[model samples]
Target chain A: MKREQGAARGLAQRMGIPGPMGGAHMELNGNREAVVEGCGGILEYSEESVRVRTGKLAVRFVGRGLRIKCLAADSLVVEGFFTGIEFLW
Target chain B: MLAGLARWLLGSVTFSVFPQGGRRGAGERFFSLAARSGASLWGVRRRGEAFSASVRAGQYAGLRAPARRAGVRLRVSRRNGLPFWLRACRRRKGLVAGGALAAALLLWMPSCIWSVNVAGVSGPQAQELLAQAELLGLFPGVPRGDIDPDLLQQSLMRRYPDAGWISVNTRGSVATITLSERVETPPVKESGRYYNVKAARAGQVVSIHATEGEAAVSPGDAVAEGQLLISGVWEDVYGASHLSHAAGEVLARTQRTAEAEVPLRQTIREPTGETVERRSLRVFSLQFPLTAVPAPQEGYSCTARVETLSFGGVSLPVSLYIERWEGFQEREVVLTEEEAAAQAWREIQAQTDAWEGVELLRAEERAAVQGGVYRLQVQYTGLENIAVESEIFTGGGDEMTGDSNVG
Candidate 1:
């Protein structure tokens, strides 16, 4: 399965496809807020941290005053003073 | 900010969720279900076992299934935004009607011309100009867009030939007409025509200087009013008549008499140190009195000033009327004989100074007191120029003779 996925990704890149990994995409706006597109669902939420499930990994946001400003079907907005973003596969 | 505005325009509802059924990770499950159902949420807050958020009003009903499956109960605590306001307005028809009327009036007021102002003109000519403007379809209550300023100016110039220059300017709802009348210069007569230099006033001729024509009087001559001082006609050695306009100066001593009087005993007013002020407002032609204080019975002097409202260089009918009163008491004043005499002399001196064609070279004053009043008389004597221009009649003759030495 891993080899097949790697081959598929290589094919997508050759075909000029963008974000073809079927995983979440993170966009940071001035380190004050972040928008995560293609997120699966929320796993944990707190004032200082928010953990969400992406396709093949878990994305964690560590920050101060962290809160989910917006949550939609395919995207979520996080607002705070962000310290770091980490992915656990 | 755009996102917030979008939410406001689309209408948003806030609801609180309380976790129940002792479910593990109920808050996370609730979010997962809401995301799966494609519902958007914003301004999420969590405290202990309760969570709150806002969602679009259309998505609020569908949120219940997700909240129930996640073992959380939802309660919509607040409803706001434009959708709610419109819903409330639908029930109150009078408010909506009044709002519509006010909006209509505001839009219509500035489109109609409220006043026509005519500047740089006055008197009968101004009235005629305004009448012409009215005939040209420019007047109060006419729609502003229907009047063309350039066309109006062209028409005015055509209608009033005497207008040297004319212009029309419109500002807001007021139209202003600026114009100037033609200035005509009098024609100058040919020097060959005959004219007599006459005495402008009754005076003793102190000196005579003739630049043209023949002198009719000598130095120290007494000339009566309208008397000819220079002759505009002369005869050659062969007895042939000649004609010309006379020009000369005749200086003379003129006398003027002036008299004044003052009373020895007079009535004066002393201020009682009391004052009152009253103000009122006028709208259109209706007067509304605003003061509550009663009128004072004591002697008082009242002064009033009315200030009208002006907008865009045009005065409106509304005005503020203000009246101020100063109270005073009557007192009898007795003047000494010398004081009364001096007062009478001062009054006569003022009148003598104002006399035309004369200066106060000398004055004689006489005063007598009768019935507590002074009777005064004065005579002022001074030297003055007494030359005037008088056109000589031709009498249909090419040669004219004039009277000489008429002083």
Candidate 2:
């Protein structure tokens, strides 16, 4: 079932249509907030860096004063002076 | 922010774990287990070898297994929210009991009337009104909710027939009674009875203003005591006599003689300056003496000073009583004849001043020594109105017959 979802997400990306688990809707607002939906779990957390797990990739937040504002079952909210975001498979 | 508030309301426990092996993934394993178990954790921080995390209080029990699996020792550092406070209260039952008692007292104190004030009345009637209020169950220490102002006013009006109007009002713990008393009216006199204006003293008639009678004497006319100054009987043109009530003012110059005597030797009380004081507690009608000093008899004078606390117009049952005993001795005093006569004259002068509308024209006093006493005889001449009214009695007959028999 996860493979089907992954295939569907790939097809949607190719067709440029939005779907579930479409690489975790990442919203960076005002360089101080980062919200990621469809998140799995926290891989790493610190004042300067945070790594969150998604369905197919790991999202690393690199910044100063980076702290987890909220952590739920399927969402993650990080707040700080964010400088960059890197994706690792 | 809303999520944080929700977590707080649900109650949360923050704990720190000391990892045995210095392994880097110890905190991560705890977070992974928390996520798998559907328990959200936040505010996770690290201090050297210890890692702290906040989890919902209900999920804290589930974290012990994860801590053991990760080879870490878990210790709860802090607890927050409402459930923790309730647990604390259960442990200290006395604090809970005290809080409940305070709330009960606050709700009960205002329900009773601690004071009662009686307004718009005073003197003997004030006492009477208070007595009436007591009979109606409207007094201090009575429950405020039990009194109905309308019913109390009606009861008071029914009790005091002389009260024209009455009103009862309540504010908090104080009750005020406002009332006005009824005015009494004089009775009317019957016109059938014959009344005559007569002289109360022997004097020369200086002026006469007769309102309802014939003038029996003119001004400057000399009259004797018991003389009739105004005649209530009149003769008609048909030679019939008619009687009526005579009302008038007659001014006259009258002579009054007053004699007084004062003894040369007199007995008086003198204080000996020796005194004793006692104190007591007075509760209602009962007095409990604090000191054992007995009250003096006969030659000692006792004075009492009482301090009491009153609410509204009602006196409370508590008071402090102070009794002071002063000693005194009786002694004889001798006076000269001149001093004795002067004292006698002062008494005579006070007596003469009691007559109303009396204008003194002349006064003469004679002093003489007599048998261990001084005698004073004072004669005072004054101009005053001396007319007095008297009812004339007649034989048993119908008043319509106009009987002339005046006895």
Candidate 3:
């Protein structure tokens, strides 16, 4: 009976976890952290911590030191910053 | 300080512009006029030392320097440039080259056949003279500069006595052999040996009128082939005196007999109407036929067949005139007396026409029957016995008298 119950649990765990091709559904379930640099009108990422910098007027500057959630069973948070010359709040 | 120095260098040049060569005479005047026109029209002036000065942007922008030291170098720039002829031919380079060619032609025109015209001569004589002249190389294309024309003419005259005159005329760059050849008559070649009148064809003599020879056969005399009808000499009954020979026609009735056993029933499919066509004729050097046939052969319709007779590049005085009797049936028929007489007379007349100028007497025809076929006999006698004559020329290209196939 114990062996039978252990096998059922293994199947449930496998079903819950997504493979490499699956998107952010397999994330921490709450807040995402990424920083990228905007250069020549493009926002691109860095490795240590994604840093986004709008070097020229090609794009708007976004994101400063916002911390993402790492606690809770499915904790998740989105951090975003955008500054357009013309404000559209 | 260096930039200031460059500035000073540039400023110094901008002030005073100098032209090296002094302008003089017509060529300089023309150059000045062209330059002035260019400047006035487009404000184009002296280009600076820089290569870019020739460009539109360089011309429009202020120059860094006033002028460069490039001077116009002349390649045979005549004090009066290329002669008036060249200057006049500003447009037609071909004409200039052609003029040079024409001048060379003027220099070179003394050679080639410009006008191979033969004047003062008519018919065959003119043509004969031209061939002789061509062989002599006295006509056009002969180098006029090298030869003494008068002496050349005299030599040619001696060679071709048939030519009344020959002259050379040069126009710009063309040489002409203006020839005037005299009309010539057929040479009468006298054999000097008097011949007896023998029967050319087998015939019976019906009548005789001896002109100069002794009549050997009387009227109604049957003479065999080659038997003498009249002897060239007369012999006395005693054979005492040897007499002189005479050159005259012996009138004797010579019968030319033609016998035929023609089939009687003949289906002669002849056309009811006839079509005749005539055309203009030319034989190179000569204009037309010297036979002097009046216009077209009218009355009895005939099919026209005109032919031009030419010998090499030289055209003859005579032409092949053929009367193509249209689609007429060449019917075979048993001829009656009248038809037979007409046919015989026509054949005899044709033979007579061959020697038209010579005096020949013709006799009335006689008819007879032999072997179920009637025979028609006609007779003729020559009035004047003419002898053929000829002379050998050195440069005429014809072989010497005894060397030709024709007698």
Best model per TM-score: 1
| Residue-by-residue lDDT tens digits, candidate 1, B160-237 | 787788999988977889998777878686755667788988988889887777888888778799888887776679
Candidate 3 CAPRI level:
incorrect
My TM-score estimates for the predictions, one after another, are 0.55, 0.51, 0.29
lDDT of 2 by residue, A1-89 (tens): 97997788789889989675435777889889988988877788777778888878888999888777656667868898888888888
| Order of models, best DockQ first | 1, 2, 3
Top model number, DockQ: 1
True lDDT of residue B233, candidate 2: 78
lDDT of 1 at B261: 74
What is the full ranking by TM-score, best candidate first? 1, 2, 3
lDDT of 2 by residue, B1-407 (tens): 78778877889998897877787867766666666667777777766557787889998898888777867888999999778988889999999999899999789878877656678887667767877887898876678889999999999998876788899998887788989867677845676687878889899999999998788889999988778888787778997878888879999999988889899999989999989999999753457999998888788999876666786556565678898999999999999877887789789878887877889999887888888888888888999998988777765663433323232
lDDT of 3: 0.40
Candidate 3: tens digits of C-alpha lDDT, residues B1-407: 66344333332111112234642222222222322223111111222311110111212122222122123221211111133335468779888788788899765544433334444555575556556666666443445454454765676678767667777444432333456757677845344433445554444555566555566667666656555555554657986432223333333334333223322334566664564434444432234444444443433446544344545544333455555344454565666756655555676566666754444455555666555344555555443322211222223432222312111
Model 3 chain A worst lDDT run, 10 consecutive residues: A39-48
Q: Candidate 3 lDDT, tens digit per residue, A17-54?
A: 43221111222222333222211111221111222122
Whole-model Cα lDDT per candidate? Answer: 0.82, 0.81, 0.40
Q: List the residue pairs that clash in candidate 1.
A: none
Interface RMSD for each predicted structure: 0.9, 1.8, 37.7
